[model samples]
Target: MDVMQRMERLVEQLNQYNYHYYTLDQPLISDKEYDALYDQLTALETEAGMALPDSPTNRVGGELLKGFKPHRHLSSLWSLDKAQNEEHLLNWNNRALKLIADYNSKNPDSPLPAPTYVVELKFDGLTLNLTYSDGQLVQAATRGNGTVGEGILAQVKTIKSVPLSIPYRDGTIEVQGEGIMNLSVLAKYNETAVEPLKNARNAAAGALRNLNPRTTAERKLSAFFYNVGYSDGISFADHREMMEFLKDNRFKVNPYVTYFDSFDGVMQELHSISDNRSSLDYLIDGAVIKITDMRTREVLGYTDKFPRWAVAFKFEAEETTTVLESVSWNVGRTGKITPLAKVEAVELAGVTVQNCTLNNAGDIERKNLKFALGSRVFIRRSNDVIPEILGKVTDEQDGEEIIVPEHCPACGFPLEQRGAHLFCNNRLECKPQIVARITHFASRDAMDIETFSEKTAEQLYDEVNVHEPSDLYTLTYEDLIKLERFGEKKANNLLDAIEQSKGRDLASFLFALGIPNTGKSTTKVLAEHFRDLTAVMSATEEELTVLPDIGGIVAESIVSFFADPFMQASIQKMLSLGVEAKAPEKSSAPVTDSFFSGKTVVLTGTLHRLSRDEATERLEALGAKVTGSVSKKTDLVIAGEKAGSKLAKARELGIPVMENEEEWIKLLDGEQN
Candidate 1:
């Protein structure tokens, strides 16, 4: 088919699949087949020398914005200080332990028990700022210098990782999210770039700051929404549950993220992630451990830049002593040449350590590094994660210069030498890039086709000529039977899935498009709020920022997604194939005053008459704002059995305190009778 006809056909196919997988939560095609078609379109667009206004490739990366616009935060966005070293971390842990111990000791009559800590990955990326108006996405910015930040709503939209809308029943709310790059994608991008990145964190940071948003669109930056800044209607008793609620709202939260039951468990989890960091697809600089209960956090209170209830354990690089047998060069997706060190097999963290990587030639020259086929080197891992040779030279040894590759190892392409690095010019045809891109297209956050394994995708890319997501529709049972062990039933089932997936919603389709910065939750929010795929594809800056979770960055991504020809064609093709893309209904309520409407209510002690959920629900239903613990800002404190600090604080603050459930009920009922 000619370029236009090819484009027309591709758009019809992609649109249908987009509706099925995203809207219906069901898919028909294998990831491999979809990827092949997507790749073909991308290739065709590149060759046509024409740009479509709406294309998936356009949302990949973004431009570095000018200086921040100095937007004030509704609540001060605070930065957490790293627990300087192991000793400091231990001290902080002990302090928390002692605080609980002392509290129990002082209140012998009815002591409070210590609760467990929740630990999570401290992602290395830009802190995204989002504002919501009546539970809709409205504004987004970056944490520029903490207090003031630039508006990046347009730029942020390009990132598929961030949500375009929030899931809350409130008038206004602000949230904080983190933008990050995964190791797998980073590895792939670096393999294709002229200068391969040293790490995912650096790459993510760089991608967020690109001068041209169009350039930024190529990096595939991802992010996770974590915090609620301001709230009007919704209430969360526990911090962990709040996260769960965010997930329920279709926000793409971190799955590896977990909460703990105790201090020991939290510490163990921290250590475990550190040990297994190399295996993780994303880069983490430290562990963010917090009190799972919101009340506990409120009771603990805040320091200058951090909450006293939370702490971060930043791990140092992991170093191992090993004998280096030999060194060899390898080509990456971006064509950058890297050196690999063959190490003697040694057991480390359950797995036998066989090979460690050396970043570039500069690293070799820095340590006066040499590979005499047998040399000793200390291998250092990132965040105690990935194994890499830091340097070498045992006391009694002669030195030798490290041998570097003169050509690409994978394709025999001529290597271009640069400062401290070498690169290959084989861009699209590169094996690593092809495999990685195809795999990425078929990933769960993308088309979401079930039972499509990476191994199967690899076979399609290598054995079959499949290169994009839409290509799956072109395949037949005959195509599958040709492969080893391919049966009629399996092939038909795969085709059925691909066919059914044509009706996915817009966000999933956008996510499946693999737009940079766009991740799971962002897609969901966009899909829900925009109503139709075309609206998002054609959304302006003002329009995107009007949504809850969508920020400058995410807005930009949406704009870019629609700006690209390939992505647009994909949408059209899916639509032609009878794909239906529509958003879920939004809940709306009138602003009528209820009992708790204007009252600031604080609960203290334990209530026998009502559970926390019941109490909060009634208060919220009545329009009352229930805050955690008791403070000077408290309007009224409802005291139950054995009220402690909150009661004392209420009295000290001269705030009115309700003695029992009867008194609280009386106030709610507005009855002296």
Candidate 2:
């Protein structure tokens, strides 16, 4: 077959596979077989110097748009009128029936019948409007103000479930759907995600609006079409018929859609959805009941903001009344103090809720919450996780008002408010703060001290003289055996882990120092730039800020940390305890013809050809300063699979990108830009 024919065949096959796997929840081919086909198609398309717009390769990503253009929708996407209870649903139904009757009386020849409702799950996600012209996807937009929205065609094209080209090829059609992040996808994503998304709705919204389509692809967002915003080629007798048409056209329609002859049937279905909501893969905040017949819907038209033909039956919030026993301040690893409310145990969503997050002092004050001892409060458990206090339940101010702590709970140091949070100024001196720092220093990501635990750190702090990172090196087996649960094996293993940690590389050692704003990636950048701990400690804020990935705030924090006499003393003590902080030796490759010579490069995402360590070494060997972030000063960015914010920023700044391992290796071998 010719190249174009082969491409056409591949696109059709891939679309079928996607439909089966993502839409139908069944796979006809193994993942390995599918990948082989995909690779073959990609190579053919690249060699042919042409690619169809509907090719599956588009799912990988697209060139970043300069900015989202404003798109005026063909029809205004009206919001649903909400019904919180059976009474509300009945009232709406009664009003809708009366409207239909009035229309029937006015037009005697064409009488509108009593409205039958079409019930569907109300997916808790961002609303999207997809426009198709002649069966090919043309424009995709968000629901900004019902009438207009930002175009997000590139990002939407990355969703595997969203058909790039449909079977119907007649005229322009607009389909409305909810772009949802599956609960399972969110859970898997949060497993390795740096910042876990709060909920599926937020994740879906964030992915849809992301500047880079690559980021959106990584999110694995799905869409479920329910409404027809506008259509020219097709006509449907009812909402159910339109939904069936959407499903037949390869659009994902909600499977739970059912016809309800009466308000009682609609209420039953609404309750059923609410009861089993936790078992569903996607989030649904409510159930929507719409008039079944197209003619009846027209007769009972729309209000100012909502459709009169439909009403969203909102599920009652999962909340319960509980008594606030006491409020306590807990210092986190970063020394930021957060308020924890000890509430009287209450069952919410089949789980016993005790402590609830107060968020911050501002949240408590804004809620006008009396965090006084033994006050009645309402606690809600949303998404079946960490419960939160909604507000005070009683008007009586029967207990003492909760006050922000003046001193750290773990140590006696004075607390200072930084923006909305309160932080302990004493970094190394506080007991809990010191233990947390030491525990983090020995964490596997930092120093790879596998045997170290927070419990051990606390024990050592209270019983032994272990107060800082340096104190950990001073711990002896004799001192450990004196603790309550310490035995010979455990103590020996912990000591061995500590000894091994002392020999960690400069990057790990830098991270182990518990420097504020310096994560593992930042540590790697700092180590590559300065080459040693001494250089980093002596560097001024201006010098540090100029280095790759080091911003003004981080530089200031670094300088301030090193300039402190206590931090200096701690470092000196650690060095005296035989801790060897050494930078990795450079490669012997000559740097004269290197493309990376004197360039600052940031590496984001996962490289297939080399591990992150190996890639960093290669870049540094060629006189490049490898960094963790992309900034305007960055000369190049080597982006690989699943690259996120850094890649977006690099493209936004018009920084050059090395897309794959081959390009990166070529550049390392002195290939010209």
At residue 667, candidate 2 shows an lDDT of: 73
**Per-residue lDDT of candidate 2, residues 191-230 (tens digit):** 5575556567778999989898999999999998888889
Best by lDDT: 2
Candidate 1 regions with alpha-carbon error over 4 angstroms: 1-67, 84-87, 97-113, 318-673
**In angstroms, how far off is 616's CA in candidate 1?**
50
* Error in Å for residue 349 of model 1: 12
Q: Which predicted model would earn the best TM-score?
A: 2
Candidate lDDT values, in order: 0.67, 0.82
Q: What's the TM-score of every candidate structure?
A: 0.45, 0.52
lDDT tens per residue, model 1, 1-673: 7897787577557645543443222466877888888898788888887634334444444445575455777777877757856677677767766776677788788554467776667777788888778554566778887777767665666665554444464587777888777777876775556555555665677766665676666777777777776677677888777877776654556545666676667666666666556545565667787777676566666777787777877765344567777777876534677888788886654456788877787666555464434676766465334577645545444545567767677778788987778888774466765565556655665656666776777787777777655566567777887887668777777777776666665666777766656667677767777777767778897887888777898788778768978657766766776656545455345224554567788886668878875787577656677887654456788877655445645764568888878877865566212
